[model samples]
Every structure is written in C-alpha cells, then in structure tokens.
Target: MEKEIYSLRSQFEIGLVTDTLVMLLDRGARVPLIADMPQVIPMLRGLLEGGLRHRHVYCRDTDGVYTEVVVFKERYDLELIESASQIRHFNRVLAKDSTL
Candidate 1:
C-alpha cells in the first residue's frame, strides 16, 4: 500500500489521475496506496474503506479503469509520501466565481 494524500479539509479540491483512496482513520487520514501505474485498481479497493470515507477518482480507460482516492480529514497517518495527486489549484478561483 502507498500513501498519496493527507490532511485534506472540507474545502479541499484536487485533480486526481491515478488509482487512489484516502481513509479518515482514528489517527488521521491515509491513502493506503496510489498505484505507480493505474492498472492496480483492484488491488487497492479492499483497503480503501478501512472504516473511513474513501473518495475514489477514476476514468474509464480503453481496456479497463484508472482511479485515484482522496480521504478527508485534518492529518495523514503515513510518514513518507512517495507520490501525490495534483492538488486543485483552483479552489480560490472557483470560490470567487461562485460569488458572482
């Protein structure tokens, strides 16, 4: 299992392109694994919901599926980060547009 994202808040938005799952654990939030390749979706499914809300991002590929997960919380349990999903840099922009 790999850790992709941690410490995501309610207002957090992200653009994910890989198989990922974020779990809000008693300790905090954690992504069990973000496959180095998107082909490993099935391997990460079971671990995705270990008593936590797992937000999975996926797109249908030509042959199969690709996914990435995001867990919502205050902190992450993982000690080291090997990879990361693209953080949504447009939260503030979207917020501004919503006011109009």
Candidate 2:
C-alpha cells in the first residue's frame, strides 16, 4: 500500500472563486480521507498559496471562522519534497473558457 496524492488548481471567476481537484486514476480506491469535505472551501488556490504541505492552510470559512483542514498532502516525499507544493502551484488557478 502507498499514500495516495490529490492535487488541484483554482482561480477567481467574475467575483466568485472556483476550484477543481484532480485525483489520478492510478490511486484506485485509496483516495485520501476527506472528512466533512463540504465545509472545506478554500480549494487549491488558497491552499497552496497558504502553504499546502508545510503547514495546514488556515482560512476563514463562509461564516468568517478559520479551520486547519484546508489542504493536506500525502505520499509526497519523493524529491525536493519541501518544494513540491510551490511547484504545483501555478498561475492558472481558474478554468478558462475554450471559446474565449
């Protein structure tokens, strides 16, 4: 068994922030546990920006409260493990319209 990893990208659209998480097919049914997922809303953008792997990304929820379950990383200890987070964080956080 191995630790499964999930990554995502997000961006702001109009006035609301949209996010998307990508789970590789290779992970199979071993997806990481996401207890009470409905409450975590920062997504990859704020998560990676606020330190996705180094420390728990804390952000104010819809009610203006903070939580430590923003983004958690798993099985990411390959190389430059400390830097993998930033490497994944890129400029394209929001999905673009193909017609545009």
Candidate 3:
C-alpha cells in the first residue's frame, strides 16, 4: 500500500508571548519548538505593551480576499526597514473603527 501524504492548513494562527518565550497555535495544535530568535520575544513584548503597532492591508482576488500584515522596524530617524529574522505575519488586525 502506498502511503499518502497530507497537508494541513490552519484556519487561525495565534502567538502567545511572554518575557522569555513565544508560543504558536495552529491547526488546533500548540507549536512550541520555534527557533530561539533573540529579537522575537522582545518585539512581541513591545507589541503587547503598546510600544509597537501592527498595520494591515487587504487585497482582493478573483477567488476571495486576504489580509497582509505589514511588519517593519523604524529607526530613530523614522526610516522603516525590514529585519531579516523578524516575523512576516500576525494573525490579528486592528479595525479602523475600533475604539481601543
């Protein structure tokens, strides 16, 4: 019998950050074996503490629509740059009419 390979797609991806760790949830499973990236923990912490902002852009296609989260680091000079090791996507987006 030939074994069939299957690919699982996660409906949602969640990140939980602490002072020392970042955890992810996908496909109803907890993924705890993430690589030890030094900046990720602190950046996530900053984001939780309101020191960072997450921006979203939505794109429409013939099939449907998808959202993109803009991730970048801004320097003191206000120039935005991408970090090679930074996370490329966040699961949540702030609504434009949100009161928070």
Clashing pairs in 1: 2-33, 18-67, 19-67, 20-68, 20-69, 21-69, 22-71
| Candidate 3 local lDDT, 7-77, one digit each (tens) | 13312222333343333332232322122123333444464555334422122112222322233553211
- Residue-level lDDT of model 2, residues 65-96, one tens digit each, is 22234343432211111343442342122113
lDDT score of residue 42 within candidate 2: 38
List residue ranges in candidate 3 displaced over 4 A.
1-12, 15-23, 26-33, 50-100
C-alpha root-mean-square deviation, candidate 2: 14.9
lDDT of each: 0.30, 0.29, 0.29
lDDT tens string, model 1, 1-100?
2324323221112222223333222112242223222323333344344433444433222222233233335322223222333223223333454465
- Residue ranges of candidate 2 with Cα displaced over 4 Å: 1-51, 70-72, 75-100
- Model 3 global lDDT (CA atoms, 0 to 1): 0.29
Model 3 TM-score (2 dp): 0.20
Error of 3 at 50 (Å): 7.0
**TM accuracy, model 2:** 0.23
Worst 10 residues of 3 by lDDT: 56-65
